[model samples]
Target chain A: MILLSLLGISILVALIMAFIGDWRFAPEVNIGGSLLTFIVSLVLALQVYHEGGSISGSTYFFVDYLNISLVVLTTLVSTTTAVFSRRYMRVEREHGRVGHWRMRFYHAMFQLFIFAMLIALVTNNFGVLWISMELATLATVLLVSLYRTPTAIEAAWKYFILCGVGIAQALFGTVLLYFAAERVLGAGGNALLWTNLSRVCAQLDPTVMRLAFVFLMVGYGTKAGLVPLHNWLPDAHSEGPTPVSAVLSGLLLNIALYALIRCKALVDGSLGSGFAGNIMMGFGLFSLLTAAFSMLRQKDIKRLFAYSSIEHMGIATFAFGLGGPIATFGGVLHMIVHSLAKSATFFSVGHAAQMHGTQEMAHIRGLIRGNPAVGWGMFLGVMALAGMPPFGIFTSEFLILTATMKDAPYLAPLLLLGLTVAFAALFRKVQPMVAGLIPSGQKQLSAANIPVFLHLALVLILGIYLPGFLANWFHLAVEILK
Target chain B: MAHTLAAQINSLLAALILLSAFALLAQRKIMGLVHIFAWQGFFLALSTAVIGFASGEHHLYISSLLTLGMKVFLLPYILYSLVHKLKIHRDIEAVVNIPTTMLLGIVLVVFSYHLTAPIRELSNLMTRSTLAVALATVMLGLLMMVTRRHAVTQILGFLAMENGLFFAATSATYGMPMVVELGVALDLLIAAFIFGIFFFHINTTFDSLDVDQMAKLKETD
Candidate 1:
């Protein structure tokens, strides 16, 4: 409860500070507040360990392994990114790319974005969750169009219309789920509660549950940036502020997946595994293959990373869909690793964009020669993203491949093929910028953010050594998934 | 006797909704399109109000009032003013010529009735046949959007589509909660204002209200 309070209040405090109207200290205040919140959450995690399993709420909140794990990821990344954006945004201001009021607007929207994500994660009610996700989408839409150029506006408009329709579908699907549960539970509002639904999931009609999953997946999948529906992701990422791209890929995508996984649990639990798994596997493979090939032709830097995010999400979905302890655990680890690595990649990409004056690969060259910290950091981030050995993605991907190979031998080949295709595609785009001769741009002050570096380091360390306690928690969480 | 009265009223309202969809499709003048759209909204509000009274759900009553105020009264008024302000009384450049659009609109009505057949079976007894009518209104509204190139015509189509959705809710479930209805009503009104301003901007930029001109704004190598 203390951790939850801190996590929730950090956003409030950040919101308060952003409105303080002193541009310099507002971001600092936000960062410091989130850091304090992080420390508090860490303490609460330790206490949870001491008590051993389950500390739920009276109403509208829960702290089971599933959400508690997600909260930790969300808050930790959010705090780090807040600290990172202070430096990142200040650099932009110094460069004259953005103005003071716009800075305030950015800070305000940033805090609100975090607040929305927290609400979506913690809210037990499906209606509240739907509303929170809408809030998040709206906040990010504003951020995506911050530049207000024709292209940015076009991107934001496309995002708004498509996602508006998608969220409406989710809304109708949610109403249907309520209708499905209402008859069984004799509903007031308990029919709409996640915990309550999970508890009585077995009693619900399988046919209704199965149909609901289709709506939930297609609806949430649009937000998750799954290809065919992923048209918005690359554009939004390419066009938006970089910190937002980081959060969208790292946090927002995960949030959508988390929602789907919750829905998947309901469907899987009710109808048995095979029915849901078949569709999940199909969508996952389709997304992975599409992203793999899509990355091959990409020239825009942020867009390249956007496709990689999709590929990783596909891997995570494939893992959970494969349905085993090892696979589910692997999926969770991949979620965490990819979040950290990809955020770091964006941080570097943000810096590289600042340095190069353009997002085009043709315009950027020899990042290492230009600024070793950001250059090497981007290279390392790319290496990690491409699932290189001795990185967290590698461990997670390996676990997934191994688990699939052992259980569903047919899926293993597809997984391997997709992985190889992704690796090649990423490297093909990555090599030119990271290794070539420096193009024409003045070398700027390199403050490749310390938090981003810290994130990369933590991922590298975890790849080499999964902390015993964290592993235990993931395993326990996987058990909960089952 | 009461059930028969309720069924007759619902069937009448549904018929009005379907007829307006046809009128919207066949209407040539943009001003006529706006008028037909307002008429559709009027039918929707009437149907929902009737459903609310029949069902005894007070929220449905509140929703019907909102549907009336926004969709029928305020929205049409705004569109009329926008039409006048933009001096856009000329016939909209229909994406398909009028006769073909009407033919297609008829096809959509038939298709909608087919689509709503199963739904009609499990529907509220009073609203049984209205399901097909509501679906037909929805398809006709969609047809209005598709075959119209003018921004004002497209807005008419969108509003008409909402009228269909409102009618569907009434026919299927007696209506969505009052709060949701009000929220959507507010959203529609606000959207109309925003889109109207956008239309004005588009007109000034391109010197035409036709969306085909905006295609030139799209990316080209």
Candidate 2:
């Protein structure tokens, strides 16, 4: 009943906000409603008791160990992004970049985007899952192009093509899986059911499942920003509003990975796990290598960090690909830490970009000199992402490397090489942006910096120590991440 | 006689797809590409329908109608109006020489046949033989994307890729469900609208729809 109410409350709030559209009050109403939704999601997460073996209604919505984690991560980042948007948007209005009418649309669509992702997370049917992802694509495309600049429009279009093709490939894979499943169960809509498909996997034809896994990986791989498929990531990140960039990097990418992991679970249950992990490991290594080297060439600040995200996602993928209990646990932890750190990083970077008046790394100088809060935020963020001690990323990366050395010793150095290369490249670019002389024309720090601190603090505490319950949950989720 | 009829129809279907692909290869004007794309859709619809009649699977009929409506009539009409309004009615020169493109296309066709033959053997669908054609269409569309300079042509290439994918689905497995087919058709419609709007904005901003020109905006050298 509460789940239904939570859904109802979010929609009702959105509907009321849409109809009212009081120009001045839009942000406050939306922000307050978002806080309400976040609180509700927190309650929803607690409702999912791990020992009870998952709670599902007759409807497609259910709380699994996998998606409940995503739901919480998405809601937390979304709420933070919203808070940051309140300030970023107000600045846009003051600067006359966005008018009142468009702000309302952005606010509404932001809500709708979150709602779609949550729906996508909870959906048990594959068809509904595809539709939900399609919704996310449509929503984010609009957001990406919101600025109406030529570059923004082009970036949005490119993002649409890359992700559209990816999702279509995913659609083909989904249909193939459906076809394979239907042959075993002998037909109809239920063939698309996750539980039903998993139950019947042993009897399904191997050839179709093999082909279907390829399509699924390629399809979801594109969305996950795997190398060679990551062309749209940096452009979309740099051109869009920074909050959107934050969520795109931190949240949407994880949801896409979650989709692939779910499919991996099904395939592994059927085919005994070796082929799938090998492919993920191959793609992961390639992505990690490419993104690390790509970072060395980055000129724009957020673009550089966007590549870092691709790199971290690669590491997470490698961890998942390694697939023992320790590795899978590390992968999940890496995702959570990456989300907090990346979003916080972007939040700080957004403000920094505004104050410095350019995202070009060469133009901004002495970040610490001009503003200590955002400058230190970036420093801490980069540190955490670089996998240094006392941050959650270090522990996760350590766990993954140890696990890799034990099971797949040959891949261990490749993992270390990717991590170290990325670390050096990021600091090489970050030094001038942080420690040099303050550049001219620095605008006053305007956007709220609290969200950045909050995110960093959470990551800080998690690095030092994880709550026992969350660690246990991460371990259990590891089994399926295999 | 029945066997000959079946072979004749399958060969005709193959010939029609290849002819349209050839026309698409040589076609230069944005308007011309759109027209050829619609014709290619026509061939696909015809091929799927014939495969349906030959195989007696009722699902392919819906797939054919979807191909007809979304591809032949709807997408062409949208592309035509989009280019007309944008006033870019001139022939677009390919980045790669046309002959080279044509040669590359032939290689792609041969490669696709090599790839799809084994998979085709696994399926009982009689349209299985056309799987290679379907794959070639996909490859050709990708090549078109690489060769074409104009944004409209890129969009044409993307739509063509979808056409190839649809053919693959129907020929391989009788078609996706009606609901999914409908959803894809709707998505294609909306995608076209978004792309069309983007074209106008791109044209107005940079004063041309040539995608390669926008490479000037890349941040890193």
User: Which candidate tops TM-score?
Assistant: 2
Best by DockQ: 2
Candidate 1: C-alpha RMSD after superposition: 4.1
**Candidate 1 chain A minimal-lDDT segment of 10 residues:** A167-176
Docking class of 2: acceptable
Q: In terms of lDDT, which candidate is strongest?
A: 2
Task: List the candidate 1 regions with Cα displacement exceeding 4 Å.
Answer: A1-22, A36-58, B1-4, B7-49, B62-94, B97-221
lDDT accuracy of residue B93 in candidate 2:
55
- Model 1, residue B210: what's the lDDT? 73
lDDT of 2 at A347: 89
Taking all chains together, the TM-score of candidate 1 against the true structure is: 0.85
True contacts kept of each: 0.00, 0.19
For candidate 1, give the docking quality class from DockQ.
incorrect
State the C-alpha lDDT per candidate.
0.76, 0.80
Q: Per-residue lDDT of A114-162 in model 2, one digit per residue for the tens?
A: 7777777877777667777777777788788888887887788788877
- Compose the digit string of candidate 1's lDDT tens values, residues A1-482: 68467646756775675667345688777787667767776766666677776565645666667667777788788888887787778787877867877777787777777777877877777766766776788778767867655566556655755575566546545654664576577534466677788888887766656656776787788888876778778888888889889999999999988887888887787887577777777778888988898788887888889889999999898888887889899999999999999999999898888888888877878888888888888989999999998999999999999999898998788888889999998888878888878876645765646877888998899799998988998888787777
Residues B155-219 of candidate 1: C-alpha lDDT, one tens digit per residue: 67766766776676566556544444554565565456556755665576667777655432232
